[model samples]
Target: MTTIAVVGGGISGLVAAYRLRTRLGPDARIVVLEESGRFGGKLRTVPIADGPVDVGAEAFIARRPEVPALLAELGLTDQVENPSSARPLIWAGGRLHPLPAGTLMGIPATSGSLAGLVDVDTVARIDAEPSVPLHWDRGADVSVAALVGSRFGEQVVRRSVDPLLGGVYSGLADTASVRATVPALAAALDAGATSLTEAVGRALPPPSDAPVFGTLRGGYGVLLDALAAASGAEFHAHTAGASLRRSGCRWEVDPVGEVDGVIVAVPADRAATLLAEAVPAAATQAGRIPLASSVVVALALPKEAALPDNSGILVATGEDLAAKAFTLSARKWPHLGAREVTLARASFGRFGDAAIVDADDDQLITLARADLATVSGVTDQPVAAVVQRWHGGLPQYRAGHLEIVAELEAAIAGVDGLEVAGAMLHGVGVPACVQSATTAATRLLATVAG
Candidate 1:
């Protein structure tokens, strides 16, 4: 039996190993090495007074079909449910506004529902903004905020884009690169249709029955557990990988002990130290890929809280609090849950901004409380609040990001029988990470076969 060592037992590594097992039949021996004691990495769904609440990614975007399809393939389809039955809030221009419809890339595609969303001058500029042509070099990289702001206006970036995209990338617009983050936006712009209006119009998928976003009935942890089970991958929790070096055609991965044919899927910084000898240049690029630390405060409130119905609230930066965004977990997926059990998630810190990551637990709860009260109108103290600190959660794919990623891949090729996976390359979402897992595993298998 051929042996493959899968490093990092996060969802990405587990999924990759699972696919490899499925593809290689029973003959392939797979082992997963996780630097942390836990296997889920960023995935955590803890029990609160009301029920379980996710501390990591809460929902999978609707347009991404692979995640839902994969859930079904893994027998986890029944676990999936839409995130919300109510409108979400976006904080901008000193107030929270209902996320306007017919908007894409922070630009409103139509004006009917956006009346009170923007100021008069900003509204007129947005109205007259000729479907600004999105002209970007295919091979080069650009900032998502810069691209969006340039095409629509700065207001769009400050008002619309920052609130939603900020939560996903968990980074500033200037630092968040387009190709590494939202490639579709870059692609649409390159295809030449002035303005996100035309770009989104042309790029929008044909209407389908796909739900907007879905979370697991039990929480995303179910999917993580399912992946581990399917992979039959053994993980050493609480173990920290010190380094990795390539010897001959095989790689030596040190995560407590040396393992053969290793795949390093940890953060880019760790990847740098691990792959330094085997792929020095790639290690350099990996080290250069900046990562941001963040803290997630999951506050569970009783259903009888003093607040109107809202799916969730996203707090913009420079607000009364430091949090970038928060989600009303219970409101988003009530069918799978109960009204008395509202799960509010407030995430702090983005790429290069680690102020909140080191904040004490009490501070986290306090900030979360104030933000919830200001944004959601729920001033009642949460019955239960758990703080999860991810030292390096989100990677900032700055402008010119794709070029470096390509260089890193090339450097990885110097060492054989190795592959990279996870958010460092693709994104911080569940779907994109899964997509990277599948794609990278396929390439790894083919490399080994060749």
Candidate 2:
């Protein structure tokens, strides 16, 4: 009987273990070792005013087929729903501005759409951009900020790009890789397009009536619970994996016993620590992947509170604000079953911005409330609030990140009975994590068959 051990009980790890069981049949033994007491790493859903709300990742990109496909397999296709409101406001210049329409990651199709949002000089720079010949860096990856700023000017990158990307990855656009973070833009650059706006327009998938993202009616917790119940793998929560070693043809998870195969699905740093003795080269490559921490403050406000009109407000980098972004949860996801009170979530911290995240819950909440008061004119205290601090929560994909990932994958593949899958490997979204898990499971199956 072949038994496989999966470290880290995140969505990636759970999905990998479940998929592996599907392939290896009922006879095979599987175990999931999670360091924390909970199963979902970042897929946290908690109760608020008699309804469930997502404190962490709430939705998955609909374009990515992995998650939607999985939902269907789990009989949750009917539960899929889009956000109630898609419009997001940008809080800049001490006011809220409508996010320019038909923009790709803040790079507007034309400067004409950015009239009052940007200053006259920035607009002038943008108007002159079409005439400016683009010096494309053909082969190598560059920062998204550099690529976009060179063509669109610094204001666009700082105001539009930084906030959007920062909201998703808690990373700075100036340091995030165009190839890894903005693949379409990178592809356009690689293809030698004269105009970035034109290139982005060409590369972007044709606009569809369907929403770009989807979420469950209850919360992501429903999906997580479903996956957990179905996986059937012996789960050992709070069982941290200290080290990994190989014994003959089988792999061993330290302090957790041995198995026929192993899948490591933890964060990059912890993954490096686990792989130290088994695969040093892979460990070295893993350690190089930079990570960022963040804090999310979920606030349940009274019905009378003046929430913004749009689904959320994104805070630009230059703005004097502690919150990086704010989500109008009640306005956005109506399927959570509305109550009398309005629910909102505020995000704080970004790459190299950890003071807020490092603070205690009370201090973090106060900071969040302060930012809320500054933006929305809400002086009344929240009815209730929950603070979640994620240490080393997000991975920063710097320039040449894909190359590093490829090298790491190659190095890890050299060792038999070992595989890795997580957010850092392919993408940062839930769909991408599922895709990575599927890939890892497929590889592990091949190993067992061999």
Top model number, lDDT = 2
lDDT of 2 by residue, 102-149 (tens): 777777777877777889998888877768888886778888888878
Query: What RMSD does model 2 have?
Result: 1.4
lDDT of 2 at 356: 72
Model 1, 1-450: lDDT tens per residue?
Answer: 567888788778888888888987776778787777688878888887756777887778867887888888898877877755578877765687888766654556655546676667667766666654445666677787777677666766666767766777777777877776666656777877666666666655567655788778787788888888888766677666666776566656564344446666788888888778777898899888888888899887776775546776676555666777777766667763474666677888877777778889998899888877877678877888899998888787888777888898887766667788888886778887888888878888877766
For model 1 the TM-score comes to 0.92
Worst 10 residues of 2 by lDDT: 330-339
**Residue pairs that clash (backbone atoms under 3 angstroms), model 2:** none
